[model samples]
Target chain A: MAKPTSRADSSTASAATEAVLGRGAALRGRVQGHGNVRVEGKLEGDVAIDGCFAVAQGGEVVADVQAGSLDVDGALEGDVTVSGAVVVRAGARVVGVVRGATVSVEEGASFSGRIEAEFDMPPELGGKAAR
Target chain B: MAATVIAQGITIEGDLTADDEVVVQGTLRGKLSSRDRVSIDAGALVEADVTGASLSIGGQVTGNVTASDRVDLVAGGKLVGDVKAARLTIADGASFKGNVDMDV
Candidate 1:
């Protein structure tokens, strides 16, 4: 596809603006951005963002997600990779592998997925010694 | 107020649907559908089939458009697609190249 014309000023402003998928909206493709994003509806494609990503209470996602951080309060059925943290809030239902620096699930959240937290292995486990 | 905004510099590929208003200021491809108004702001670029209750264009759109109420092509807007609406308006400075169906 041809690239969109870039206006320097607009690009800068866009980097700081948050993208919101409104309450009843839905997206079925790839979304790539440099700013934070919030979803309150449905998304059926992969999402890659340089900033935080959130799924609101009524939102639903069925694709892979990658971001700086992730906060979910809705339904997600895809793998997630976050550099910072992953928080599944109350009433959220997620079903996929989750990889992050920290992963937490609220009391009322429903999650059925593998959680991968990156951590340095201690030398006693032959981690550093093996290396 | 538009509940969803595809802010400047963002790029979306595929389909988008909403129940409320939507404003686009960036690049979007595939399809766009809204139950309410849809606005394509100046400098924005959209290449998709768009459906909404009302539509106002101030940017560039390349595809088919279906508006239940009205369609307005504002000044400086450029559209290259078919339009279907009950009412249509094209500003003096707007550019359009498509077929129009007012549902007569």
Candidate 2:
């Protein structure tokens, strides 16, 4: 088993909490941090999350996003960068660029952008490269 | 307002827009915009550009943050990016590696 990390390491390894952007809210600018964040409203700018990032089906965002993992169940117009994976659900609209180790575009999902990435298996997932 | 905790079962990958009083307990990967206090609970994972009136972090996040008010880092929080806010507080147990641009 892997060695356990200290409280300091744990805190550094993980930050923030589950955040949600209620419906009807509108925003414009830059946002960056670590944690799980959800948007069900509207946004126009740049966003980066360290953990997981999700866009609710009713949410709409126009900007660039980077994160460890991504799940889109809403509408997004911009670029995406992910260290882990990107999952685009049905009825989702995405227009921009994306770079990630793994990307999953669900059926009925529309996408218009450039994709650049190389999948790399995690340390915990050794000898598992199914490309 | 509530305790912070971003459970791994949840994942968000897109842009986010929020209003007053927010507590993250899931995963958010995108741009975040808020008008009031934005909290990042422990176990929460976020990667996005952030904007809020005030911010309280307790999870893992990357990117920049621009707060009209102040930005606070609670214990068990990890942030890696730049910040633009009037005030920024990093708790002793908080982990952060980034730049700070105050007076914005």
Best by lDDT: 1
TM for every model, in the order presented, reads: 0.86, 0.51
DockQ each candidate and list the results: 0.79, 0.12
lDDT of 1 by residue, A11-121 (tens): 455456778899999899999877777889899999988677889999999989998899999999998999999999998999999999888899989999899997767
Q: Comparing chain B with the reference, what is the TM-score for each candidate?
A: 0.98, 0.88
TM-scores of chain A across candidates: 0.82, 0.78
Q: What share of the true interface contacts does candidate 2 keep?
A: 0.17
Q: Which structure among the candidates has the greatest DockQ? A: 1
Backbone collision tally, model 1? 0
For the predicted complex of model 1, DockQ is: 0.79
Please estimate how well model 2 matches the true structure, expressed as its whole-model Cα lDDT: 0.75
- Model 2 spans with C-alpha error above 4 angstroms: A1-3, A6-16, A120-131, B1-104
